[model samples]
Target: MTSLSVLNSALLVLSVALVLLHVSATRAKPNKARTLFAIFCGSIAFLMCKQLSAASIGPYQFLIGIGASATCNAYWLFSRVFFRRRDAIKPQHLYVAVAIALLVAMNQIYMFLKGMAVFTPAPDALVRYILVELTLLLSSCILVLTFWEGCRGFGKDTFEGKAQRILFLSVFVFALAGSKIAKGLLADNPQALEYIISAITLLVMVSTQILLMWRYTNHLDFLTTIPLRERLQPSAATDATKATDSRGELSPLARQIRDLIIGQAQYLQENLKVSDIARELDAPEYLISKAIRTELGAANFNQYVNTLRIAHAQTLLADPDHLKTSILAIGLDSGFASVGPFTRAFKTKTGLTPSEYRQNLQAK
Candidate 1:
């Protein structure tokens, strides 16, 4: 094998290993991020195998070709599943993936038939050109979407979360997109240049997987939002004791702030802000934020308030008396400005939509 083929072989092995690792790790827990990550890795593996032998023709190669073509789509979905707290993989997302896959498959089948001399196109035919442009357009849009997803909610993320987001945008989004643009611009370059570009791209991908594995093994919570139980149940104390213990963890000013919020149920105000809390407590806004972050272990004032709101919403969700109450009304009563943020936050914490959680309660 040539040196390029040997490098591709090594990358293929590494990519396949990462896929297996992600799949094995998620087998017992069924983590959506890890599962999607496995698919992303599999897509990389397919690309590497394609590079090793570009002219392979068979049913299996056709399927693998489709997968290699959907690399951008797979990474886009993986980014959404990784970064977004809400329902990331909606029905529309699946439809788009299927559509992209089908488009690529059609192009591949066209090429296969032409190569076998079973089909021919007119000299003026635009079918091939149109299909190629459409695929490129869709892939570019998906890349842009992936970057947007990585940027979304960045201001609200924890320090670790922000770092992970930045890392992904730098390593995967920019690197892959740059490689594609370079390849397109250099379409007539020698085959060796293509191999060099592919090697660099594969190296970047392998490095990303290594970093992700390190993050996963280190129990980094950046990949997902904090669970509701961890946010609420910090210890084994009873509710009354828990209240006292929670207050005890804070400084005197923080305790006073907590008392003012909890004692008067200020969290139900819906438009509550740190400035409002600071004004009521005769304290500075920065101090109030610091108290929440340091004493409450929250990423910010909003997270602290949302934790309380989600806890309250959980109570109302499980209440038999409020079984007939509208979810929107319950969410509003719990201090959410609107249903969208409320639903997203609730799902991030609890891994269930408001409706699903309520339904589960009813089932129980």
Candidate 2:
């Protein structure tokens, strides 16, 4: 191998080894999701090293194909863990995996039998490359969606959310790497594409490994402090049940509540009330009232709303955008009934008022 190849191989090998060690060490843990994530990282590393070598391209192509397929397969498993899917990996999910694997196998066989370049494209390069990019891109999106879905209904506040966020972010960066691969195939820019893809893959690998180690070794579980008992109030359970069926399927209302809380976390500063949410949702006021009290463990209705609003305002106050927006406006928008409540809540939650939080964020 040339100097450049040797250097690249060394980097790839080191990265893979580090990630593999973490994955192997964590395999005995009870967290299946973490284990699967480790496996996913190992697979990605294998593909990265294979692609870097470009020796005959067949191994590279096969690894890439399996990696793409595995990325999607991992999503179902992730969702199952996130949602506590009782059925485990269902037959349909397996069927989908089998289908993707079959495609990868067929693509690899055709490339090998036809004496085609594994990494390089022929006249049909555009079509082939597009398929590759789409497969990986779609798989990354699926994983992200699973994480997003899991964030609802007391999901975002847990270790799962943090893990999901990190994993999804890594997957997104990796998708960028795959996109570079496709770009290289489509255009004549070989060296630029190779370097870009390699760098991105390296970044993704490092981030993913760190996350795996932190989650497994540190036993870090985000949002685990929130009590499950408080989250299971009857009214909330009814709402939850409404959101999920007797079969524990996700209800539309459940999804709506998750979207409302998680997506508009920033908007909580508007001093939102249960009645306001009910009006906004077009659901009955009693149901919303019951849901919050039961699901959230709020001693009083107003406190419940302020909790989210205050948290959001704290984030804004700590953001660079605080320079553009006033503390009072942020308070009001965060659903604070008045300046006093906002200030008190902000201080209590963050040990700083809105103004102070913003100052700190800017300083950082």
Per-model TM-score, in order, reads 0.56, 0.44
**Residue ranges of candidate 1 with Cα displaced over 4 Å:** 1-27, 55-63, 177-195, 207-217, 220-364
Clashing pairs in 1: none
- Model 2, residue 206: what's the lDDT? 58
User: How high is the CA lDDT of each candidate model?
Assistant: 0.67, 0.53
C-alpha lDDT of residue 273 in model 1? 83
TM-score of model 2 relative to the true fold?
Answer: 0.44
lDDT score, candidate 2: 0.53
Say which candidate scores most in TM-score. 1
Runs in model 2 with CA error above 4 Å?
Answer: 1-14, 56-69, 79-88, 116-167, 170-187, 213-364
Best by lDDT: 1
